[model samples]
Target: MTTHVYFDGGTKNGTTRIDPPFDGDLYFQAGLFDKEERYLRTDEIQVVDGVTYTVFRFTA
Candidate 1:
């Protein structure tokens, strides 16, 4: 099955939203973890309509 993954999808109303959804699973090392420790940093998976999305947030 094909998965729709979105990177740096951005936020909406303080919540992550899938903007310009991608066709497949795409990911990178950056914007995924912290510098000190390799900890997966992201928000809860949200289901909008019937689509489920795993949104990641970068730390400042």
Candidate 2:
């Protein structure tokens, strides 16, 4: 499955933080940038239920 990730344009050092981190290579859409960001490699984050998630990092 392909998951879409949106960045806040707030980068620490070099790597930018993304919401709902996806496993492997996936689509990365920039929220506050003017450039094109089709995809990127990211860590996995999944939702388990309505109030629960596999990796509760971002508050999606």
RMSD of each: 8.1, 8.7
Steric overlap count per candidate: 0, 0
lDDT for 20 (candidate 2): 50
Best of the candidates, lDDT: 1
Model 1 residue 16 distance off true place after TM-score fit, in angstroms? 6.9
Minimum summed lDDT over a 10-residue window in model 2 is located at 51-60
TM-score of each: 0.31, 0.26
Residue 49 of candidate 1: its Cα lDDT?
A: 65
Clashing pairs in 1: none
Winner by TM-score: 1
Error of 1 at 41 (Å): 4.4
Model 2 regions lying over 4 Å from their true place: 1-13, 42-60
**Whole-structure CA lDDT of model 1:** 0.39
- Give the per-residue lDDT digits (tens) of candidate 1, residues 1-60: 223332343332234433454433333333444233121235556565677767444332
Q: Give the per-residue lDDT of model 2 (tens digit) for 1-60.
A: 333333322231123333454555444344555443454333544433332222212212
Q: For model 1, what is the alpha-carbon lDDT of residue 57? A: 43
